[model samples]
Target chain A: MAQRPTKETKQSSAREERPPVVREKAPALAPQRGRPTLILVGADKGGVGKTTIARVLLDYLAANNVLTRAFDTETPRGTLYRFHPDQTSVVDLTSTSDQMKIIDTLATAQVRVSVVDVRAGGLEPALQALQDTGFLDAVAEGEVGFILFHVLGSSIASLDEIAEVAPYVDDADYFLVKNHVNDTTFFEWDPVTHRKYFEKVETAGEITIPKLNELSYEQVEIAGAPFSTFVANRTAEGGPADHSFVLRGYVRTWQNRIADEFDRIRLLDRIAGREGA
Target chain B: MSRRTLVFVACSPHPRSGVSTTARLLTDFYLSRLADVEGFDTDPHAPRYHELFPDRTQVIDIAAIRGQISLFDRLLVDDGVPKIVDVWQRSYDRFFKTVKEIGFVEEAHLRGVEPIVLFHVDPSETALASAQSLSASWRDLPMVVVQNEGAAPLGAYAHETLGHYPSTRRFVIGPLDGAVAKTLEQPDVSLSRLLVAPPPEMSIVIRAALKAWIAPIFTQFHSFELRRRLEGAQFLK
Candidate 1:
């Protein structure tokens, strides 16, 4: 410039030249309808019974007559899909197209509640993806509801995962789950350390899944049916099943106990968009 | 019309509180009528009820899950066969807890099975309290208090105390002559067998006394069954 530009002018020009932080736009709002809820169930470690928690959530939602659809992000084959094939789809949460399939249809889907079962060691990435996709923005703006069930294993490292996932869930309903379906003992953690990690997310709550009888659990797995279906003594095809009444009784008792835990947490109220209502 | 199956649960929390005696009476009563009946003896250590009716009864350890399935699942079959269970003193708490948890009573009703808890009332305050507690908690279940005068007789005060229970139904068993009571306790002596075919060595006097002692009790059972059938008919109507 013929007249040497002032420092303030140069700074202003540089600021104006910076590119904008681009974000995918939130999906269009449904016409004057109830806000859709998305529940993400995941764990940092494998074999932590996170999938079992997802299955129980589906059963619980169905029991409460909540119209719910589920996405199992376990690649091409999802365990939740096997039990509840009618209402579930297998998807890859990392893929942009798959994420669109879930996010874009939120307002248009007939079912208002969606459960996403994140694969093991995928919670951080999944949460990061939600942050990047403007889905979390939709949650912040009250256009959608978000819930995170951070299923924890019995180890100190599980606590670390909680801190990592805590940032993305500040505006969401967060729960830490201790699943004892397969394991018997909950490893003792130093109270101070435990409190430190737990307090990282002040609003997070704890849920315990009681241990079910081994034989009963095995029978349910073998039947390849939902817990409620097995308890009803029905096959995967909705036909009469010759399941052992003992195993069915055990499953019913276990399922009822899990339902009690859900009730204690007011899960129905939270998921139905009726909290404090 | 199909008859509703009856499952009589003879239970007492105290040992020697006439639980086995009540179960035996019910089993013998059904057997004498030629009704299809099954008995479950929940006494893991001493299965006296099973021993008394080996062909018709099975011993089950109700503390275990498998035993619970065997007892409760079979009871729910509703095959029109009357069922009797002699719940041992040690297994009493576990038994009722499981029943409540499984909602066995309501399911039994839906399946055309009526479970009647024949609670043995002794002279002890513990017995009275247990009965009162059960009456308060299990209002849906039909409970009958059985007072066996031979084993655990209640004095006037104890009887008056038991009268305060919410249960309106009460059954009295025996204040039998010493000899009749002793003879009935013999392991080989089955009341149903005695009624059907008395042993040759048994004297006519004792047999007649036994018949006199059992006639009114059997009549009581018959009346109860008639009333239940009428109730079922009314329900269907």
Candidate 2:
């Protein structure tokens, strides 16, 4: 399906009046020519900011002009859908019809990216479902761009879940995110313990989501807007906002840092393949 | 809706340029007017301002994430509470680097909180060069060259170098009496408080000397803050 950009009752945007948004990426970058890409953002444990990371990835891809669609596996009334309702569909990942809906559309959809906000405790089952469906095999043949964002908490089990999930993403882009956006600690694992499991994921490059100011993060949650829109001091519909300048500053800084991690990992190239980037 | 909240990052790239002393003075300046002020002493090794005003000040380590959140988060609040962060020469680059990278000045401006970098000028070539580098990087933000006359005579920094700043406002923090300076170095000493209730043991002569020493510097700072007020602030006053 050709997904149109969300056109909520548009208002005069603060971004339109201000100078152009600063681009740290290649300023004149073109759309990716890569194969249809599927990015799974998931964690075995809950509250690791997996969905939060997924939202940031979608925002980053949107900023780069990637035609991106999303599947919120939160079943009904997905939080992802709440923030990005127009581009997202809440689907049960285990259902056959839903699996086909996500997998079959990869090649046919106008969008280049398919981001799945895999629900809490649904990562392994989702991966196994894909494996059983022979989707990873197709991914290996270069028919699609497959990437896994394994958002890990600061627990040993979170690290152990890495080994369990590594087998499924062997042919895909694997990333272990040490999310500390709201957490006080990112990794409770000692250096040796971290390195042991870190060595297991063959192509995994570490991506860190830095801590955001508690107030700014909460404001975004309250506004129900994407981080980019929040930084622009606008609602999701692009209307001007009454957000505190200081809080917006904090969010802008936090957003740039998350983007920096994506840049460091060359996430665009990985999702688009070398030629597409 | 702001009352012109200002966050002054009083610092020097090189040590021994009397940054801590001046930062303490700004804190005292605000405190003297009974204005709400918080002092952040960034030198983890030794926090002089934190020692002097334990209740009003906090010691911060910008290297840690929590420290950054606590310091920067509070710095932006426009409660008519002026904030002063004293940069250790060691944490100087990291502190300002984070500020610039995070667009702290731009964000602060939007919230009606102006960030002023008070670069302490000394009688060294490094001080002059540091001033030049900062003037270039912080051109959009207001900056002031603070000449510590007690450390060295004024005009050590080249006049041409100083002229390059977009809004260069120089202030002197010295010509203070040597004896009074030694007394103010006490951990419990606060010049603002000293002007208030005179200590029982202190003679009237000594109190008068203290007032005389700080009068000119305080007046200079008062005008400096007055200049930074937004339009209509003067009319309201």
Candidate 3:
């Protein structure tokens, strides 16, 4: 268990530096307090509304009177920055490294609400490193981690993938986030078909996240910088005009439905312990 | 001798790029404060979100991830050193059950040396801890405790359980960015190595407004069955 001589040898030779390892939890503001709330927005495929959903949740927490922050494992182009400025968010231009630092910062302080957006395939590796580092155990000991999966029409294929990765999510509070609903017929999988798809994941011993829908053109534009700036404005352009017709008229209705359910999952209530709503 | 490879783990919906989006962000954030940080996106090969960002980050694609361990092993062997990794977890518990307890153990055995495990506490420990508690199987893994405040006891417990491992470490940060960090007087181990950095300036209001306006889009996709699907993600069909 002594420090390896090889590491010393390598350092001695080139003076090259490895990224500093973050094994212990970061220091906190104070000690005798509660842990922060950590929420993860994930989906196997791109365009499944992972970033969008995470943004909405963070916005809700901020608007609804909570100290909230957003983390994007995906870099430079943080979804929050598409709309808000740097001061408005801990938007890391570097993505994963920034995310780890922010998490370390938050874990040290134990911020109340922290929303995370994972890029399509990065979840496994990032989680692997965190586990190796032991921050996962630290976070587990302090906060509640919610896994949010955005599904549209319950693509059976996507669900099958979700099942394979389900074991990785075994310990967290899982929520299926149905996103970008252009129509509302409420999905119903044929029991037989559903069961068969699940078998694939089980047999493979891994989650096979089903395919998902990406945001529409209007959504993309809305999530883009120029338009996001308009939305971020304070006056007419900032107020309502900033948002696109699609986002204002349709997107809100769609996103609210899921948000309401989260409100219902009563995670906050559970955190507060029945004393508050 | 082969140095253990570095592996990053987390929940589903991984970014397409190879390097971690979160790790890239933190590195940029810190490096940016001092100087420019180059980023590269290697999705097709690494396929992780962090890899997809700017060219400043050296994004590894799927191909890179496929051989990430061996690659690191070779690099470390050539360097004559044990592999050092900066692991990032979006949440605590998810990490505890998977990487720290399971993967780390394996990596240690494979590399013939202790693999460095770094945990990022992104503003919450309750949910993370709850998840670990639910998974209870990895109760005995060495973990470096992270918290805002009053999280020392929890950290101490974890430390006592796994602190015996030579690879274990701990730290705390806050009281500046509207955060709190607490511990019982002094940790059982020497608190000399704790890494406390200045809190990043992040706003809650802007984030909230963003969510409210965007909620409908995400909310519209929910339903009783969808909830069931989410809960039963383990048994998806």
Clashes of each: 0, 0, 162
lDDT of each: 0.84, 0.78, 0.40
Minimum summed lDDT over a 10-residue window in model 2 chain B is located at B158-167
Q: Which regions of candidate 2 fall more than 4 Å away from where they truly are?
A: A1-34, A182-192, B1-98, B108-115, B121-142, B150-169, B178-237
Order of the predicted models by lDDT, top scorer first:
1, 2, 3
Give Cα distance to truth, residue B99, candidate 1, Å: 0.9
For each candidate in turn, the interface RMSD (Å) is 2.0, 3.9, 19.6
Instruction: Give native contacts recovered, as a fraction, per prediction.
Output: 0.33, 0.33, 0.00
Docking class of 2: acceptable
Question: Model 3 misses residue A29 by how many Å?
Answer: 11
Give per-residue CA lDDT, model 1, range A81-171, as digits (tens): 9999999999999899999999888878989999999999899889878877888878878788899998888777887787666656767
Here the TM-score of candidate 2's chain B is 0.88
Query: What CAPRI-style quality would you assign to candidate 1?
Result: acceptable
Docking class of 3: incorrect
The candidate that achieves the highest TM-score relative to the unseen native structure:
1
